[model samples]
Target chain A: MIGLYIVTGVALVISFAFDRKKTWAGLKKGWMKFYKTLPSYLFLLMLISFILLLSEDFIIENLGQENIFLGLLFSLGIGSVTMMPGFIAYPLSRILLARGVPYMIIAAFVTSLMLVGVVTYPLEKSYMGKKATILRNIMSFLVAAGISLIAGLFYGELV
Target chain B: MKKSTRNYLLFSAFLIFSFISWLVQYDFGLAIWDNFLVFARDMVLILPPAFILIGLFDVWAKNETIEKHFGKTNNPMRFIYSILLASTTVGGTFVAFPVANALYHKGAKYSSIFTYVTAASLFMIPMTIMEASILGLKFTSIRLLASIPFIVIGAIVLEKYFEKTAYTLPRVDQK
Candidate 1:
């Protein structure tokens, strides 16, 4: 996150140096875009928090507690629907992996958590168009599943 | 309803629910509040600069330039370049989506945009390092390697599928 700020800061300085008027306009445009999208983000945050609270136990238990197929399905479903920042999701997956959970389930959860965002699909559609948003999510879901299956096989020793 | 008002209503509804939960059970309310605050703080940490960079990208990069680089072509170089650019980007999926949309509006190919979106989420440096440290090098390596071909293939298929979709609105054309 600090890296993002530093890069943004430097880019702003360069933008200003190159063209003051354009830079100001760009900043205004940025704020407008940010503001325009802020509501969706806030709504998602609220929904995610509530979902997180409700699923705290459910996720911990069902993500890896069943047959491989069911566990994979559960992980993919939960991860797809839930919106979590990478920071939180990665560490949580790590903990799950350390706890003797199937790596396939952990992989599915982490991959889907990053790639598929059902919770934010509307927000994504606002930008990418409805068809494109749905297509992207479907592709990501399949790719995430593929990644998990491959990881499961290649890293079988870990499991 | 106005967009702002609609959003405000949604937020207030959630707030009311939280308050009622608090009245019914203190810990539930506190937990909800804590989760919201954590997300809010992370958003504060990331959104400002991410959006600013996006704004700068809009101001500086030209539509023709984007098209020239990422527009429909069978050129393998474009694929490599698109993946590299998106993979190294700092923010997660949400932050990358608008930038990819901007590129799309600028006439970049849908496949390239899809590739960028997937790569941005999957191959971020900070996230990769974190995953490696936590999940072990073997798991991280295998997953990363497995994902590349799928991302490439998915990008091409999506591009072909969405080829008819028109570019919506260019930022520079936004008045």
Candidate 2:
């Protein structure tokens, strides 16, 4: 990310000397596109929060006092299907973790949170190559699930 | 009816699905204390407008224009700008996809678009905070760091492999 910042900055500086008009045009296009999306994003967040509210029962029941592996599996499944924002899930996760859910599942679930979810899938299909998107998602879910299991076991031993 | 109403009906269906899930398991029914849980769940979701906007952006943008900026070239400027753009754009990895598609149609290179999606989806601060809150800071740090290689390798490998697939898919301009 740092590398990108420096490189982009240099580009901007160079652009000013050679072609300010082109640079301004790109920035304006990007900014207009970005600002226009804000309201919609807020609405999306609200909708996600609502979806999580419906699944409160699932979280409270399945998320408590389980082996780490099961938790990981559950999280992965939910992550693949659900569209709730990570912010709402974070608090729910905290609640579950304190209740004795295995760290493995929690880890996997957290990983799944950002990487995989059905809600955003249509959009993904639109922007990315369909095959690539599906394959990447499958790989991510599997990796997330496995990483959680290993991390959970290690944490169990250490703590 | 209206889009909102349509979405509401769809949501009701999903709610019913959850209820069926509870019936099958029975263990997941609403506990007495946290009755408000269901309401709270509804607050965080992807809205119809957002979805529409994503689609519109995909449909409206020119392919060649986006490609010129983000295409698989090694210009340091394009690479840096693309990375920063990916990092700050907020949404699920999937939401970012439509943008990538829009960019692709506008002629963004396959490699840079892939990289942008990879970064946008995985490297967001929101994700980091969520992990830290749930498991602990150390765990969060480890997972975040670990994902870096996956993003890089995954984007590069898939970008090349998926190039033809994009051309095959329905373009917004065609419609």
TM-score against native, each model: 0.90, 0.60
Which candidate has the top score in DockQ?
1
Residue ranges of candidate 1 with Cα displaced over 4 Å = A157-159, B16-25, B164-175
The candidate 1 chain A region of ten consecutive residues with least summed lDDT is A150-159
Q: What overall lDDT goes with each candidate model?
A: 0.80, 0.57
Model 2 per-residue lDDT tens digits across residues B135-175:
58887776656665565565567666766554443343221
Q: Model 2: chain B TM-score vs. truth? A: 0.58
* Tens digit of per-residue lDDT, candidate 2, span A103-154: 6666666677667755555445543546766876776676566566557656
> Can you list each candidate's DockQ?
0.60, 0.14
**Whose TM-score is greatest here?**
1
Q: Please write out the lDDT profile of model 1 over residues B28-62, one tens digit for every residue.
A: 78798889998888788888887787777887898
Question: Evaluated with lDDT, which candidate comes out highest?
Answer: 1
